[model samples]
Target: MIRLFKVKEKQREIAENANGRAPVKKQSAGELRLHKDISELNLPKTTTIAFPNGKDDLMNFEVTIRPDEGYYRGGMFVFTFQVSPVYPHEAPKVKCKTKVYHPNIDLEGSVCLNILREDWKPVLNINTIVYGLHHLFTEPNYEDPLNHEAAAVLRDNPKMFESNVRRAMSGGYVGQTHFTRCTC
Candidate 1:
């Protein structure tokens, strides 16, 4: 049965070559789903998506979020998403490309989001993840944190946390760590 399908595929390729047209590459199921999700995306005005590798390579892309409200307001954060070929079934690997001073994001750019971890389900789409990231900016959770120091400050002294965030966003030193300017 598999041989039969291969023969047919070869014939189709021959026909295309004879017609002076390149054979079309078959898209994986994950790619098809990603394309659909991207097409139906309803991104917020403060967020934008880019294909740094070009539109043809949809598996890898960048999402930039410029929160207009909350502690992260006016700060630009960039995240990189790498969707596996098994997509939907396996959550996309997301990494924060911009260093942010938040409880949920560590200095090394590791994001601590429930949806990106154990809470992730196949039913969740790219839109859900984007919104989840945006929510993190608007409401940084101190309860479940990746940066314990930031979380402690946010939990113990909200004012100090705000000050640290401002300093980090302005390309100043927060504690012993120096953060590059991310304010837009």
Candidate 2:
């Protein structure tokens, strides 16, 4: 039975080459799901997604968010998303591309978003994650944080925390960590 299947595949490949066209690669289940999610995306005006690896590679992409309000207002933040081949079943790996002073995002780009971790469900799509990230900027939660120091500052001294965020976003030093300017 396996031999018969292999013979049929070989015949199909030959026929594809005879047409002077490359054999089409079948999309993985994860890739198919990601394609559907992207096609149905309804991103907000403050958000934009880019395929830095080009249109051919959808698995790796960048999402830039510019919050219109809150402590992160006027600041542009970039996050990189790496969708796995088993997506929907597995949460996409998200990292902060822009180093910013935020409780939820650490210096190493590791994000502390719940959906990307413990709370992730198959029903959630890329749009849900994007909105969650945007919500982080608008309302950073100090209760759960990746950057402990930032979280402490936010929880203890809201004023100082806001000041540090501004300084960091302007390409300045926030407690010895030099952040790139992300304001537009």
Candidate 1, residues 1-184: lDDT per residue as tens digits? Answer: 9999999999977988997877678999999999999999999999999999999999999999999999999999999999999888888999999988999999888999898999998889999999999999999999999999999999999999999999999999998899999999
In TM-score terms, candidate 2 sits at 0.92
Q: Candidate 1: where are CA atoms >4 Å away?
A: 1-12
Q: Write the per-residue lDDT of candidate 2 for residues 66-156, one digit (tens) a residue.
A: 9999999999999999999999999999999898899999899999999999999999999999999999999999999999999999999
**TM-score of every model versus the real structure:** 0.92, 0.92
Model 1: ten consecutive residues of lowest lDDT: 15-24
- Model 2 regions more than 4 Å off: 1-11
